[model samples]
Target: MIDRYVRPEMSRIWTEEATFARWVAIESLVARVQAEHGIIPAEAAETIAATPGPDISDVREAERTRDHEVLSFLAAWTKAMPDESARWVHHGLTSYDLVDTGLGLAMRDAVDLVLDAARELYRVLARRALEHWDTICVGRTHGIHAEPIRFGHKLATLAFAVDRSLTRLSAVRESVAVGTISGAVGTYATTTPAVEAEVLAGLGLTAEPAPTQVVCRDRHAELVAALAVLGASVEQLALEMRLLQRTEVAEVEEPRTSAYQGSSAMPHKRNPTTSERLCGLARLLRANVGAALEDVALWHERDLAHSSVERVVLPDSCNLAYYQVTAATELVDGLVVNTDRMAENLGATRGRIFSAQAYLQMTRNGVEREHAYRTVQQASLRSLQQGTQFADELGKDGIAFDESALDPKVFLQDEDVVRTRLHERLREHGTVTRP
Candidate 1:
C-alpha cells in the first residue's frame, strides 16, 4: 500500500518489514512440522525455531545475487541460523510454498480490518436512519419529484447495503485465508501432504484442497470482486449525499469545519469533497476487479503473471477499501440533516408528488388503471406548469374524487407505515430506537 492510501493499522499489515515477518513465520512453522515427521533433525528444527527472523535488508541483498525472492528469503533465514542447521531452513519446499502461504496470512489480516470498518459504518448508518425515521422528504425519480418518503427510509436502504457488504467481506476473508505447501507442481513429490497440513494448521490456516505451485487465482479474484462490490456500496451512499447536498436540494450537508474550504476562489462553498473522494476511489476498485478477473487464467500449472498483478491490486484494494469505509462512517456520523429543508423541498412540487397516491385511490374507486393514470398525470403536469395545486386542478377538471382524502397528511401517514416496516427490517440486523 502506498503512503497516500495507507491508514496506520492497514499500513502496518502491508509494510515491507511485516511482509518478511510473515515469510519467516511460515518458514519456521514448516521446519517444525518437518521435524515432527522426522524429515529433518530435531536439533535443526529447534535451531530454526530459536533463530530470530531475518531482516528485509538482508533478504533484498541476497535477492540481488539469487534473483529469486523466496530463495533470497531462505538464504537470509539460513544466515541467521547455526551453520549445521541452516540447510533445513526451507527443505523440500518451492518458493510459492512460503510466498503464497504468507500472502494468505497478510490478506486475512487486511480483510479483517476492512470488515471491522464496514461493521462500524453499518451501525452508524442504522442509528442515523432511526433518528430520521419520521422526517418527511420528497422521493425523486429521474431527478423529478415522484412521491413522499421518510428521510430515514432512504438512510435505512444505505444501512442495509453496508450490511450486505460486510457479509461479503466476511465470506471473502474465509476464501482467501487458505495456504498451500504442495511443492513445485503441487504433486507432493518432494514433500508430504501431512507437512503441509500441520504447518498450515499451526499458522491458523487450512491447506488448499488442490494447488499448482500457487493457490488458485479464482480465490483471489473472488476477494477483489467482493471489495469492488463493497466499494460500489460506499459510492452509492456518497452519491446520495452529493445529490442531497446540492444547493437546490439542500436536504443534507456534510459536517463543516470552521477552517474547511470548498474552493479557493468561492467564499461560501461547502462541497461534498469527502463523498466525491469516496466516489472517485470506488472507480479504482471497480477497475481493479477487471485485472483480478484477468488474473484468474494463467499459463498452465500457474505462472508469474498473476503474481505481479496481485502485488499491486491486493494491498492497494484492501487499503483503499479500509479508508473508504472509515471515511464514509465519519461522513454519516457527523452529517447535518435539515428537516426544514426536507419539508420545504417536499412542498416544492405543489402536491404533484402525490399523483401516484391519487392514481391509486382512483383505481380503488373502480376507475380503470389506465384512465386513472392519465387523469392524475395530466393533473400533475398542469399543477407543475401553471404553478397550481394538484388538488385544485383535480377539482377544476371536475374529477369526482374525495378532496379530503387527497391531503398531504394522508400521504405522510402512509409514509410512516412504510418507514415503520423498514425500521423493523433494520432491527433484524441491529438495534433501532423507536420514537
Candidate 2:
C-alpha cells in the first residue's frame, strides 16, 4: 500500500498487537461460553475474563523463538492466569479454534474499515459526478473519439460501480463473520455444540454450523476474492484517471502536492503517481486472489499447507485494498476536471465522431442503409484527411437524396440527451442528497 493512502487505523488492525488482542477476546469469550455450558466454574470464567492479555514483551520474543504466534499468545495468556482456572481456558479446542475465530474478528474489523473507505469513495464520486453533470467531454471507444458524454455521466457510472463494490463488501462481511469453537477435527470431541454457541454469541458472531480444524478455508478464500474485486474497482477508476491525465487528453488529473515530485529530472512532469501505484498494487491483489483460490484446495479435511499462505495473503490483501479505496477517494475528491480541454478534445476530430448518428438519420430518411453508410463514411474520411468540416464535407458529397435529408446540423448536435439522462440517473441514485 502506498504511504499516501494507508490509513493509520487500517495499519493498526493488521498489526501483531491487534492480532493478539483478538486472540485474547476470543479466549475470554470462550471462557464465558464454557461457564454457561457449566464446563467451567463461573469464577473461573470471570478470572479468565479479567486476565490481562499475553505479555507483549514475551509474546514478541516468543514469536521469534517459537515460530508460532497463536501458541505463543496462549502460553503468555495462560501464564497470566492462576493455574487451576487457566486449565479451562483453551479446553477441548485446537490452536485453530482460537486462531480461525480470531481471524474472523480481525477480518470483520478490517472489513469495516474497507466499507467506510468505499462509502467515502462513493460520496466523492457522487458529488463529483453531479458537479460535472453538464461538463462535456468526448467519449472514446477503442482509444478513438466516439461522441460527447457529460463528465458527470462518467462519474455517475463509476458511482454505480462503487455501489456494487460496497454491496460485495457487505456480503463478504456476513459470509466471513462466523466463528467456531468446535474442537480439533470438528468432532467436538471435548467441547459441546452449546459451548461453541455460547462462545460465538459472546463474541458477537455466529457459530459455524460445522468446521474442520480451521473455519473452512473456503470462507477465507471468499473474503480474499472480494478484497481483490474491490481492488479492481479502485484500479478501474485509477486506470481511467491515468488515461485522462495523458498529455493528449489533459481532461483531468490526480491531485499533486507541492512536496510531491513526479520526476527528479523532469521538473515539469506532474505524473499520475497515485493512479500508477494503484494499478501496480491492484495487480498484486489479483495475484493474491489467485493464491486464495489455490487455498480452497487443501489436502484432506485439513492441512497446514493453507496456513502459511493465509498468514501472508489475508493481512496483505485487506491492508492493500483498504489503502487502495482510501487513496481512490482522495483522488476522486480532488480530481481536476478541465471542461475547456474536454470541449477542445471533443472536436479534435472535427465532425467525424457524429458519423454514426449521421448515418442513422440518413437511413431513417429514404436512403438505403448500405448507401447511407457509404455516404457518411466517405465524408467522414475526407473530413479527417483534408481537415474539412464533416457537415460541409457531407454537403459536398451530393447524392440521390433530398438536400435537406443530408443536413448534419440536426444529427451532429449533442443536445441535452447526455445532461437529461444523467439528471434522471442522479436523482434515481439519490446522490443529490446533502452530504
Candidate 3:
C-alpha cells in the first residue's frame, strides 16, 4: 500500500492498483445490485463477482493509452470477467458511479489511517504534558517574557487543539462517505434510483440524495479542509518547539542521536529539523485547501475543472497529513525539555518579571495606582540596563522605604496563581473544553 513517495499506508490509499481495485469493487457491487432487482441475469452478476480485478501493469498501460482511468479499468475488467457477464458490468452506470464510489472507499480507508495516527499523537502529547506538569518555563507574548507558565500547560493546550482536529476529521469522514450511482445528470434517466441505493449499501456508504455526472464537490472540499485544519494544528505545536529551541531560548529541543549530523559547516547544531519539516509541509496542506475551495465552484451541475484538481489535491492532502501526524507524534514523544535552563533563563532578567505582581500588591495595599506603576517601571528599567536585581535596586533607591517593605519573595508570592490555573486547564490532557 505504500505510495511511491510516502509511507506505505498513505501511499497504498492512492496507488494506481488500489484505485482500480476499488473501481472494480464498485462496478461488481452495482452488477450484483442490478441482479437482485431483476435488471440483469443473476448468473452473470455472480460470474463478474467471481473474477478478480485487473493486473496493475495492464491497468497502468491501459490508463496511459486511454487517458481516462475508468475506461482503462473497464477494458481490463471486461477482459477478466466471464465473456457473457462482461456486457452487464457497467450497464446503465456513468463514469462517476465508479469514480466517486471508489473515491469514497479510498477516503474511508485513508481517514482510518489518519485517525490511528492522530490517536497515537494524542497519547504521546498527553503523556509528555503530564510528565512536565510542574516544569515551569517563561511565558512570552510578542516574543518577550510575560510570566511563568508550566510547560505542561502549553503541551496540554496543543493536545486539546489536536483532539478538536480529530473530531473535525471524524465529521468529515461522515460527510464524504457518500456514494453515487446516479446517471449522467442525476435524474436516473438511464437507471432506477433504487439501483444507486443498493450499490451504496453494498459499498457500506450512503447514496447521495442527488448527484450529477459527478458527486457534489462540496463533500470532497470538506474532506480536504479538515486535513488542512489538522495540519495547521500540528504546525502550531512544531512552531512552538522551534521557538523554544532558538539560540537565545534553548528551553526545549528535538531528540538527536550521536550519529545525527544537522549541518556540515556548524557541527554544533542540533536543530529542530522534524518540527521544521512539519511546519513546511503544513503550508502544502493549506494550499491544497485553497484548491479544494476552488473545486467547489465548478461550471453548472458538473465540470471537468474539479476532476483534474481533485486528481492531485485529494491524494496529496491525505498523504501529506498522514506524514505530518506521524512526524509530530514522534517529535512530541522524544522532545527534551530543559527544566534547569527554563529556571535559569527566568532568572536571567533578575526578578523584573514579577514587577507587575509587585505593582498590583502595592495598589491593593492602598498605594496610589499611578505612583505604584511609576515606582515598578523605574526599578525594572534600571535593572534591565544596569544588570542589577530590580528588588535590590529598588531597596538601594530612596523610592522604596526598606528591604522589609519590598520582599521580592512577597511580590513573587503570586506564582502559585499561574501554577493553579495551569493545573486546572490541563486537568484532562488531550481533551478540549470551553475556556
Top candidate when judged by TM-score against the true structure: 1
Q: Give the alpha-carbon lDDT of every model.
A: 0.86, 0.80, 0.82
Report the number of backbone clashes for model 1. 0
Model 3 root mean square deviation, Cα atoms: 3.7
Candidate ordering by lDDT (highest first): 1, 3, 2
Give each model a TM-score: 0.94, 0.91, 0.90
Candidate RMSDs in order: 2.1, 3.2, 3.7
lDDT of 1 by residue, 212-245 (tens): 8889888899999999999999999999999999
At residue 50, give the lDDT of candidate 2: 95
Residue-level error in angstroms, candidate 1, position 67: 1.5
Worst 10 residues of 1 by lDDT: 414-423
Candidate 3 per-residue C-alpha lDDT over 114-217 given as tens digits, one digit per residue, 9 for 90 to 100: 98898779767866876786677777889898777778778878887888888998898888888888888777887888888877887889887767777788
Ranking by TM-score: 1, 2, 3
Task: Supply candidate 1's per-residue lDDT for 356.
Answer: 76
